[model samples]
Target: MGALSVDELVGRDEWDSVVRQHRRPFVVYKFAATLDGRIAAEDGTSQWITSAESRAEVHLLRAGCDATVVGSGTQQADNPNLTVRGNDDPRLDLAIVHNPDRQPLRVVIDSNAKTPADANVCNDAAPTLVVVAEGADASHLNGVVDVLKVKRADRGLDLPAVLTGLHARGVRAVFLEGGPTLAGSFIAQGLVDRVVNYVAPALLGSGKSGLGDAGIRSMSGILRLELVDVARSGADVRLVARTVRSR
Candidate 1:
């Protein structure tokens, strides 16, 4: 309801307490896109969509998180390091979800193995965690990464199980830096606790929609948000909204 200053916008006290209020695993969805709601350029290029100040605020948000999550598509296409480079604090742990066994420690929902060893998330800075259906490669992926095999009825990881596993790891709060499909999954499951939008002024035509093909049709299905604060940094606008429903 009220406007926030630059310091209040990026400070730890504001988010840390709110995030810690969750006794179970809570997910924070952070995204930045064009005014048209496109997260990437026509060529799948999405580098620095928000202003430097907004991006810096993202890092601060990461610091308040226990872990950061993203889909494997983001890792393969964007090759993001996924590290928390804070301006005033430390970094958060990173997690990835992948199916078909393309990445290790990847939260996969399918029975098939498809992730590649050379994937960017298979690096040292942020180890991978594969969440796959039962009967996936149970062979020890120990030194490289950790694997979490779940019992999935359909071709997807059980959402509650995934959250339970994450909670076991002391990840009370999770930040989702997504490519659309993953975002859609979380939203559809009604698992998102907060949404942070760093709106940029630019417009890019025919690029990837934030969550491509994830049907979020009706307005009623949209997640309810309580406007916590709004701030402007240069040409960008930071809108921080917390989900009001409980899971």
Candidate 2:
């Protein structure tokens, strides 16, 4: 048989399980970090953490998801145009076969509506959804991108509500590419079903960690993950794991 399809690698059954349990899209937190688990340098410089091959793998993951999500901090820092750009491989032309014309919905959890109107995510490359606090002023993004106002949580916008809103819009799977705090919030809330981590060989002794405080105070409170797959792309090692929910 040929290489497993993206759906198989991502596990559609797992996605369905999450939807059945929470009535929302399955959430996968994806990120690249240094060997020391730092996502960025001390001054917030995070350009090109992983190899090009690893980045191409990320695009494949994005192509398989119904929606791509990020936090406002990530938006401000990277200003990425959250769209899938499949690699140029004539032999493996899977990305082109999956929704060539349409791009996955780009969702940003911006509690304060601080996303710049001219941000790349606000461009027409893909449909953008901005989730803000109920009373936050979203007028700035009114014409630039779609906006959803929800109750505020400790981390920022209510994450579960945001997922529900995405589900209402027909999203079944969400690829969460974060800037740390947002990823931590999803894990702390037990909303993450899977994690795709790309670990580079380099190390940043003291910098921005890949995850922020996730409310884990005791050893028993530690979150667990069941390793599903592991592969190497250049100097980076990609580890795909599913959250082992506690009983």
Using TM-score, give the best candidate's number. 2
- What stretches of model 2 exceed 4 Å from their correct place? 1-5, 90-101
TM-scores of the candidates are 0.76, 0.92
The best candidate in terms of lDDT: 2
Q: Mind giving the per-residue lDDT tens digits that candidate 2 earns over 139-197?
A: 98877899999999877878889988999999999999986889889888988888889
Lowest lDDT 10-mer window, candidate 1?
95-104
Alpha carbon lDDT at 109, candidate 1: 28
Candidate 2 whole-model C-alpha lDDT, 0 to 1: 0.83
TM-score of 1: 0.76
CA lDDT, candidate 1, residue 66:
61
In model 1, what lDDT does residue 72 have? 58
- Per-residue lDDT over 1-247 for candidate 1, one digit per residue giving the tens place of the 0 to 100 score: 2234323433455445544664446677789998989998887788878887777667666555566677657766876666555434223223212211211222322234344555555566555665666777645445555777767734256666777887776666677888777778777777776778888998887788876543468887666778877778557987877677742
lDDT of candidate 1 at residue 81, scale 0 to 100: 61
